[model samples]
Target: MTTYPKQALLLALAAATVAAGLTATAAPAVARPAATAVPRLDWKPCATPGGPAAQECAVLPVPLDYDDPDGRQIHVAVSRVLSDRPAARRGTLAVIPGGPGGSGVQRLAQKGAALQRELAGAYDLVAFDPRGVGASTTARCGLAPEDRYLTSLRSWPGPDGEITDNTARSRRTAEACARNGGPELRSFTTANQVRDLDRLREALGERRLSAWGTSYGAYVAAQYAQKFPRRTDRWVLDSTGDPDPQRVARGWLANMSRGADERFPDFAAWAAHPDRDRDGLRLAARPEEVEPLVVALAARLDREPRPSTTPGVPLTGNGLRQAVQNALYGDTAFPGLARLVTTAQDPAGTPALPPELAQPLRDEDAAVMIGVICNDAAWPHASADAYRSAVRKDRARYPLTAGMPVNVLPCSFWKTAPEDAPTRITDRGPSNILMVQSRRDPATPLFGALEMREALGGRARMVTVEQGGHGLYLGNGNACGDRAVTDFLTTGRRPTEDTHCAN
Candidate 1:
């Protein structure tokens, strides 16, 4: 499988809306002081292919550390597609992107039209590039190019699930970030993102901001809601993961094993179907046999790696395992994975590595992925023996992930502790939250979403889409799921209780 920062990739695999109306959610009467003087955004025409022609972009300046507002500052790139009908505009709707590395401004470009169409002219669609991401102030770890490969960044265990090399890499990566990341890298925590968001709200001069957050973005949005509950209007969390304050990003990583297990059946059925025969991609005669076939093939590759389309970067057993894990994120990736498996199974055929796996990630991308996860909370300083034991057990329980989900990461060797404890999500907020999740998301999973729901207590309602993918709303094309979320965003109405949508 392709490697990126494990947490970011986990979030990327796991990855809308708003509405308007009447009074929006009433903000608390308390007068809250702005962290700093909110600057005027000089919005200018910024158009991209398929993006709104009227989309405007600007930069919002925010402190690198909220505690030290007068210290240093950085700019967050912001974009907005203003409501076409200003007379009907309700408020600003923020589209939070997944991945510690996901570019929110780009996401606005990608999804702005659909959002506008879905909600009519009710709200201004807006998003931003968080610090260390695209079009914003960026920081790099000065990592060697070789160390930036997805496989290199993700803690994929040794061929036998041993974690010796993984431990060494973790130490090396942590040291590199310490050496070159500077304070900006240290500032890339979820808390800072929330602070940046609040600054965005203040800059927009909106008393309340509605938002749609997906994957890791859901966690950020949840934190925003927790810290500044009354500042939110309609909130939509898509494909949420567990927000256990204790585990934080670590829990999200570990949950992927279950996610993979939950989603594999869907792929197995597809790969075994007769349709695959026409494409010469069928792996087995039956769905039951697909797992074993893949398992056996992975083991064979482990023993003797196969040459790949990328010279000198042959496909390893772990590479195949990563491919399988990534392919489970969406149905569209099924064919590429099926073909890769078939090619790897061929003794004389060369397998083509997925594009993500074929090249190393950029230094900034790697830095942002590692920065957010590590900065969010402290990872356990488990001994090498502990990591080995965990990997062995996880590999046995979740072979599709091959222990990667539970494997050690650079966070394990992070020198700095989290500045603040992970924000505990709670029911103390407004009851305006709507969560839409896929039943078999290979990154977030249904069980994790349940944990988030339980965390929110009575403050939220969930729409369980009976699907086998990562994202919902405007993704996967599930009419039932889409309608439920759109209805909530556009009309401020939610299911009275938890509901399920048919596939």
Candidate 2:
């Protein structure tokens, strides 16, 4: 799983740009001859299944740090699928995967087919794993196996809002990372990712690169555009995030409070519907009753966490809330949460977390989530007390998330400060950017994505999908929103102003 600060910042910025229409030049031309004249990309087999098409994999060398260009170099994993129809081809467009830890290689596997199908071979689709990711110069924080659990890693509070245990745990986790995470762990900053992207563009031999960045990748794409405005072609940012420069990931974490509140209604309405009849999972007769039921159940769990299917792993109230939040990303996962809730409420039935929850996370995934935020910016130290106070307030205001949204994480106890300063995105980028977002996202809330849009200034136009959940484009099935982005990328046409996509 990936953390969402960058996503929120990018999404928020995209929303505002779409609303303002400050940079739009023309309504994209559907029959542009430029799209047809671009060269084809050569595809190669990737180390991973979902990476590039079977024929396009290569290693691009980059500096460990841009300031030390001649220093020890690292390799970034890259892949591409060339445009099959040159008559319809545009330019090369890189796909930026989400997760401060998400794999560009994996994203290509999952979304590549859809993109190829949609754009009519308008551009060669390309992607790469940032350094310290799969096939790249990987990093390991050497976290303890127990600390690797999702619940523990996220820094949930104790049963009764106690901070003593959480603080100690956080410190211990931080210490382990400091001790085990070597140079590679320290190297996982968004700034570094942006630099790596520029290097990738150079290696691809493209003078001006087009890109589609999703979630956290959007921040990277935005940063790259800002850094090299003249080098950018058409750019698309999907499911963006808050661009709160000071807070960065911290702000993204805090926004979860409002995000959960905004999106829970959709879940509640689903859980209460007559369709729940066959599953016997409905929590309430009316949609309004769902909120109270969830809150009360979580409170009960807080007092007495239930024994879970996994040994030594109990389902605490916060854990339940976390599971719910993750489920809200897409409609398919709703049933899993609904099942867990039903089983938890019923005495005879057994509650089981999804396999991803029950099993320990991969070391790489843990390191990504841990290393990125801590490396991106500094977090307060020993912030358990602050977290408790905030969580309590958040619980009252956003019952869907309980108090977990405002809780502390290992970053608070991280042993070191950021190696470099956070990169400030300025309006120094090309005006060839388009953004798409959902109006009510559970992770990257609309308000936060707005801040990012404001920061982008005249560089972008945003398309807001009047929908819910995390990702917006193909992920949300919003035709208008998806078309707006696809059209922009394939033909460089943007809405004159911010536009909305109806459900």
Candidate 3:
């Protein structure tokens, strides 16, 4: 799967549009009467099991098209666990999730305990599935199971970096989605997701909402803040993407090129360390040698695919490298890659797909990965040519990725033109935004996050952790950065300027 960044420039651009009276969002069109009362909600029991006892679930009705509010309506499944310490409660903080297909209900369950502990009942934790996702009204393209595999879903280029096959697959996938997905699929754009979030805010009757968004979710939170700045209290965007509207998700995928380059050194160092002998997975005697060794291994795999534990499938060098990149995002995944590398080098035995890599991806997972990119923006139909160029150049510059960073995907063949145009983010509303990022993230690079910081103008300050990984805050063990974010969320305080966290 691919990862993207978060940025603030989107807010600035969005604000300019609001001031021009070109369009207005966030605030409801109906003005409030004098002596307005604080909104109250009637909480009911939620549907998900193992959720907090106080958690409530509700189905929120939203327009399939805001301009056509009277048209078809969709149900956005929402959940919330109210503050246990009611007196200490500040306001509500929505945990906007990453994948267009990711279930917010599940996100709340996963992060709920930690968030409740850290924030100390300071805010109600809320989450929701975007329209056309789980528990919400959904759309299906009826894609075949084989086409849903991780490698297939991502549109990895052919053995020689040729994308001719990728082109056909992209076209086929796009056509299937278009033919079967119906109106729901058309409503899956970033703009629609932003609008749905606003509707959720209205339903909750909150004047403002704090948020902690990670990975792709970071962009959604940033977009919401841009569209409704006054409605945002303290916004924390973790693991951001470039705010270049023209590129959007396309740029996010391309960013893997630089991200891989920045993060590979860490792996190389780890693999080359003398201590590696203790683990027996060392590939090189020196850190610098690890890169070339990996590159050569991948080339050898490309020239000769070997039988794997899965009968019909072989672990191509690209597959091995992909597993490596995904594993590098966290320390827990390291052994799987080490095992694969060790097994591959064994002359007496053939390697198998690591258990983590063995199980085929679920359709929902594939849907989210493919849908987000296809829905966010339009990719080049000549994406194959682009991939060819990217892989050839990326392979030379960052061989650890072996041209995979520049590979084509379903977006190239996605039959639908973007159902909606990309939203222009302006610095239109409240300046209550905080962004945190790792210095050396493999998926969303630091340089790209900076572009987002630059875009936010004076509306935001960034906290940079001089660490490595795809996620920050709770994902990494950086107390300094995590504390800074928690402080802002709980107390409305922020650093006077952009700050850095030490290793």
Candidate 4:
């Protein structure tokens, strides 16, 4: 999930900008032709608290709808930390953030120091909040508080793995978005994000842009490369999912089942380790026993819900399951999950709910998450019976996820069809693209990344890190994987072929 403080920072920056009289500009009546000159950005000193003091910020105005450039306009918050050694600067490197909900401005702040040290003054680091995200133009679906919690929004099935509540919630969410999201929410999409990136390129006066895109950002990067091949320079796609145009978001969701299974063993081994005994976190004596212990604990919770630290919000079977899924994203989160599981299993102990489960997401946050996924593609019009059957099958096969991966979501009940067909990624782009992936990412697994590699074909080379986690480069990735990506970005050189990085 996207960090709440980062989201708040973006919103705070937007408010600060408005207070300083930097208002959004109105688009002209006649749509400007693509060949027309793009407006230059007005950069100023705008840094977030505890962020890099050197960071500069600006708001770029782009049409709310690219198809109607003369139509309503919205401001996209952009930030940059220039290369200290300008004499050695190659070009701008855009740090695209993951999440249909991630704030790019915040990502730049988080990774700025590490990137500067790694690249050795090769480029200026830049990033931006997409239309409906962060400090960018905002929109809301005004969803009810109960429906805005992560567990509700994620479509976890009932105690018996039934999806009856899922269908009803899906319909309610879709309706709320359609009723209150307005045009700005409708504008949140992959294609528009690609168009907005081009606008950023034009505004920055760069003929080409190099980028580091991770997870969902990888999908946007791939789309940008495909649409504007010559405009790309040294593209890096980290931990990508399949870019199947037809399946799009649906395919990404379904792939989570495999991802969860692939990542579970790593967590199991950690939880059952001899060292965990000293920490008082051992789940079982053997790695194999950990899975059954968890499964049985969940079943027991389903029968009799345990009270959590939060009032009126008890820990249910699905709550533990959701916590497991989130924890699998990175190894650093393993100990917390182990502790939660241990607490829940104790009859006298109360499990403290994770922040995501304890509180309802901000309405705008929920809007962006649902808006991007649903607007990306058309979901199958599956009936209640279909969802129930799928849930039963998935739960039987992938107990770790508890069938949530394949269950119905708001996309199933989305009122509007996609504005445009999903972009089909191909090898037609420049061969400067390099991909780095983990062998067992809980969110974007190896198999899906391989599919993305296959789709890119001759245009891309991949480095598979023999590690288990969600993100690669600069995060959970091994030293070998990190060095390969750093080498590619700083020197414009790639491995001769797809390579593996031993843990």
Better of 2 and 4 by TM-score: 4
Lowest-lDDT window of 10 residues in candidate 3? Answer: 8-17
- Listed per candidate, the RMSD to the true structure in angstroms reads 6.3, 8.6, 7.8, 4.8
* Reference-based TM-score of each model: 0.93, 0.88, 0.86, 0.93
- Please identify model 4 stretches exceeding 4 Å from their true place: 1-37
Q: Name the runs in model 2 displaced over 4 angstroms.
A: 1-44, 47-55, 382-384
Error (Å) of candidate 2 at residue 82 is 1.7
The digit string of per-residue lDDT tens for model 3 on 245-309 reads 88887787678777878887887788888888888888888899877777777778777866788
- State the lDDT at 270 in candidate 1: 97
Pick by TM-score: 2 or 3, better one: 2
Please give the lDDT score at residue 372 for candidate 3. 59
Q: In model 1, which regions exceed 4 Å deviation? A: 1-35
Q: Candidate 1 on 170-222: residue-level lDDT in tens?
A: 89999999999999999998998998898889899999999998788888899
Candidate 4 local Cα displacement, residue 173, angstroms:
0.9
Lowest lDDT block of 10, candidate 1 = 14-23
Q: What TM-score should be assigned to candidate 1? A: 0.93
